[model samples]
Target chain A: MTRFASAQSIAHDIRSGKRSAASTMQAVLNTITQHDSAIHSVTHLFAQQAMQQAHAVDAMVARKEPLPPLAGVPFGVKDLFDIQGHVTTAGSIVLRNTPPAAQDAALVARLRTAGAIPVATLNMDEFAYGFATDNAHYGITRNPHDTQRMAGGSSGGSAAAVAAGFLPFTLGTDTNGSIRVPASLCGVWGLKPTLGRLPRAGAYPFSASLDVVGHFTGTLEDLRNIFYIMADTPAEPEPQDLRVACLGGWFAQNLSPALAAAISRVCAHLGLTGTTELPQTPTARAASFVITASEGGTLHLPRLRAAAEDYDPATRDRLLAGAMLPASTYVQAQRFRRWFREQVHAAFEQVDVLIAPSVMCEAPLLDNPTIMVGGKPASARANLGLYTQPLSLPGLPVLCLPLSNTGTLPLGLQLVAAPGREAALFSLARKLEQAGLAGRYPHNTQQAA
Target chain B: MTSPPFSDEVLVAARAQAMELALPPACVAGVIANTRVLQNYAALIRDFPLPDTCEPAGDYTP
Candidate 1:
């Protein structure tokens, strides 16, 4: 078996008596013990809990009890998510002292119910704020492909852990591309479910409107299985012909040459037409920022006002600015969100899926002086979210599939489906993966470069 | 319905009103520069023509 086969394949083996859940759990724990020193993907691992859960699953198999959907699979949840009895740090010291959660977050609880054990709480950007997973409190989560490069943020640790083979798949949240960007940089497949399709009752809130619970898996089958289990609602109607539209304008034309080439390769592989003109995305990204700031500021106003010093300096300033936004501006930004979502739907009417670069470039070297794109100096913060923020506004289910060779410190093309249409997205992705079009893991960039 | 841009003095006052913890002078300067990003976004939204039927985001009720 491939060491990092998708969870669904592993589950099939476990259920068919070819592998025991206990053996899979032991293998995962051994892998983490052997490999996590350099990657630092998981912050707090529950070795005892995972083994205990695995033992129970094995006993169920022996007794001929109905197996759970994800029986014997291991996964990681971002630290921002509540996993019951652990501190939900959200990758900062401020919440480190907070009381343990009485129950798992909805997403975590769902994973458990599916028979997947969350082996650890992975690291993330502070409060899921930044695009680079350079947490001040927790050391940065290094890209598994190249130790020196970054794993895209907020969900970086989740992506890196999967890339490094610590787990087959992991759970993450996306508010403005946290899930997709990191998945792209880390060379794995991840999905951002449509907003509200997965209940957000327990995950740490970034922006109520934009924040979405998503997951990272290496294979298309795993993505489909996990998505079906995670989404609170039933599957929606599937689309036929499954035509994908290439989104150009800001994301495609303005992307770095390397990223543009990667997207081109993905389009060629899928036999999709590349278009030059698409909806204005830069403006949509701008609108998303305004809304995120206003809502984020409001969410953290009390804490920010009380102990601003406790927050990471980078996120602290952003929240403080959010607190200072005029009410009218906040209202206007929300109004813009509605219009933007409608415009996104308009684009969907023309195609079943819209494909674009997950980020403007490949993973940049850690601590680079400045991030430059296409020879143009850009906001290190703003540019990371440029390709992702527009889709986040509408809470569209986005699947990020890596395109470059494993050693290239991979880039990805994003497939965004219409709202609440995750099944359709998965169907298309499965088609691509079956045709050897989607990217997969074991992408060891370290050996090549 | 563009809101009047807040001056530096107003920003400083707002900072005070918001009870920002004592930040380093350099950090304060950085905040000012970053806030400009926010203000530009504020202007973009303010300039857009929003539908009259647009509703506030919150818990829905009958």
Candidate 2:
């Protein structure tokens, strides 16, 4: 009965004794066991530990003790997040034999403190390097909306779990659109908080300059609630009269008709007639790629030397290339980032939130694995981040909300705001959600296998 | 900045050896293909000029 339920509603159900946490946890595990074979989102299910925690919550409920806001709510984390007693393989075989994590990842610890149970560890691209969650070691995590399409990564499993309703929310890390791209393709709400806005203490590092720990949720409410709980800050008030603009130039190009029309509807609702553009966006995207490759390559250089064969070939080549990149290229990308951040910050001063497409098209079919770019097919793994990569350069907070009633599979739009302006993005997203512009993908219409 | 004149094959071989990473024979082609792609990106960033005062976005605390 708790399957597909929002975290907020589940917590409410447990606190009111409408359902025991044990039963809820059992139901969650059952649903995942039943449905996840199609999506392949889950990697390791902590069945016994999750049941124990759920029973503990039920016991506390019996005592009429004050419950944390999300007590007994089930959630998952990308395999990279440390879960105390488990090895964080980070979707790679190289670390399969490493020691178990000494403690839970910081955000996971916060959620546990608030009574949320860690239900499972989800799949991802090997070493968090690729856009396609087509992991050779873990098996591909298929898009829940359509089993044959990709669930974008390196946070693909986290997003797919939420999209498939296996978990109310799941933790993910985004360096170059990992969260947003998958969240978009999977038809869920994803937040990439301002750089450093949330702790990344235990999430496996990838592109340290760009990595930001965030989460994917089926509902906007859970996205907001869990984010504040993880950030350990009281929620900021949402501004009513917000300045919003849609991004043009690089963002406005190469869109599917449905996504472009959806953007039109939202802009028309806001009475917006003018658009804004970020300068040198293509270069910004390029810079994002170079920096991620270089940093990620450097991080694993030592291991790659000893155990390169253990890595997924799709990821191994990219990491090796990234590792081999010249230092000047890496530095120039960083320098461009500095100038670009100033420009982005200046634009933000005039607007509260900027709207853009999260991914240009709907989920790309796993068989084809390409999207139209300049009227030609391009690799989905490399180009899925076209819009998202440019935004990552400045480390702005971006909220990817699935557009409602779009074409067959789901389409998503990005609500980007100034650094630390997640509240503004949330407020704007809520407006679109209330206006019938955005919501989770309809399960009734899931793509056929 | 001028890029090295060697071919991508040479680049991979030289870099792997320099880093003391013994690239497996099977992995060479894939690595070279990836390197070529990144070089395009590298050229883009290298060509774009910034003010002399522009520094690497090292702090990453935006």
> Top TM-score: which candidate number?
2
Q: What share of the true interface contacts does each candidate keep?
A: 0.45, 0.88
In model 1, residue pairs whose N, Cα or C atoms come closer than 3 Å (at least 3 residues apart or on different chains), thus clashing, are: none
Give the TM-score (0 to 1) of chain B in model 2.
Answer: 0.82
Off by more than 4 A, model 2 = A445-449, B1-4
Q: Tens digits of per-residue lDDT for model 1 on A1-449? A: 42576787778889999888888888888878878889889898899998999999999999999988888888899998888888788888988778999899988898898899889889899989888888878888998878888888889999998887678889899988899889988889899987777778788888887888889988776777788788745555666578687877676655767666666666787787757344546557777888788788788878876677788888888877776777788777767776767677777787788787787777877766246766787655567777888777766888898763423567777888887677678777766666665666455433211
TM-score of chain A of each: 0.93, 0.98
lDDT per residue (tens digit) for residues A1-449 in model 2: 87679999999999999999999999999999998999999999999999999999999999999999999999999999999999999998889889999999999999999999999999999878888888889999999878889999989999999888889999999999999999999999999999998999999998999999999998999999889999999999999899999899999999999899999999999999979999999899999999999999999888888888899987888898999988999999999999999999999889999999999999999999999999999998889999999999999999999999886698889999999889998899999999999998888633222
State which candidate has the highest DockQ: 2
Best by lDDT: 2
Question: Where does candidate 1 chain A have its weakest 10-residue lDDT segment?
Answer: A440-449
Which stretches in model 1 have alpha-carbon errors above 4 Å?
A232-238, A269-280, A404-407, A445-449, B1-10, B18-27, B51-62
Q: Please give, as one word, the docking class of candidate 1.
A: acceptable
How many angstroms is residue A62 displaced in model 2 relative to the true structure, after the best TM-score fit? Answer: 0.9
Give the count of colliding residue pairs in each prediction. 0, 0
Q: Each prediction's DockQ?
A: 0.42, 0.80
DockQ of the two-chain complex in candidate 2? 0.80
